[model samples]
Target: MSRKGLGLLVVCLMALCQPLPSRAAGPLITPEEAALPPPKGAVGVDRRGVTRGPKIELVSGSDIASLPTRFQLKFQTFGGATVDLASVKVLYLRTPNVDLTERLKTFLQPAGIDMPDASLPPGEHMLRVDLKDSDGRAGSTSFILKVAR
Candidate 1:
């Protein structure tokens, strides 16, 4: 190619290669701005301090109670992440004619307490469960059971 043509080509290339000035940085977000709580139903936050996604519903158990036989209260978190079941406390409320302490001892075993097995007479009872997760988040639920002879 001719020297003039090469020079023109070089000039055009240089012009094309020149970098455009970068846009000014976006407005700075202070800690106060980032400290805003997640919107209702938001599960978590993103690295850019925006809401990540929707809140996840946790499944504790299907049958929280059963017959006079042994039963278990299982739980699990859905969608977001699995949370550990740290501790569970069962509050057994006795009916007007039933023994509170004795019956509770039998019903809330296997979880943590140790009690001797005994037949419970017909009566109404209130079972309140307090569950704490590994992250220190706590939740509670209740159940009513009637034992018939």
Candidate 2:
């Protein structure tokens, strides 16, 4: 072979002999991390104070739950932005006499967050979440939950 061909062959051999760099191939946030409260033990905010609203990502919980009181739902945010605390709203509504919006806020986790004290009776309920970013952008999401006593 020509000198160019010989040089190329040697380079390829050397590359094949070298060990590849190690890179993490795991999910950014694990199930355990998602189970934690807001900030949920994961990094979301930047050095700057600005943060974008979270995009809700459902993780767990089913249409029906054996105990609404202990029913668990998992969620993750889209943007790598810290949620606006003042603009964060989580509402749990049940017909006839049930609204747990304000009450749940006190026990919310970060993206992939969970309600701290969610004890409710058997019933069908609607959960609505509204969030606002530091830039004044808004996003909303919801889900239907059926709790069984």
Name the top lDDT candidate: 2
TM-score of each: 0.35, 0.48
Which lDDT tens digits does candidate 1 get at residues 1-149? 99999999999999999998542222112223224332343222112223222112212222323333333344443345333333454544322222233333333322232222222334433445555444555555555434453
Which pairs of residues clash in candidate 1, taking residues 3 or more apart in a chain or in different chains?
none
The deviation in Å at residue 127 for candidate 2 is: 1.5
Worst 10 residues of 1 by lDDT: 49-58
Error of 1 at 88 (Å): 1.4
> Which candidate number maximizes TM-score?
2
Candidate 1 regions with alpha-carbon error over 4 angstroms: 1-68, 78-86, 94-119
Model 2 ranges off by over 4 Å: 1-53, 68-80, 94-99
Candidate 2 backbone clash number = 7
Candidate 2 per-residue C-alpha lDDT over 50-146 given as tens digits, one digit per residue, 9 for 90 to 100: 3354556545554545432333344334455555657766554322223344555544555434543344434444566666654566666666555
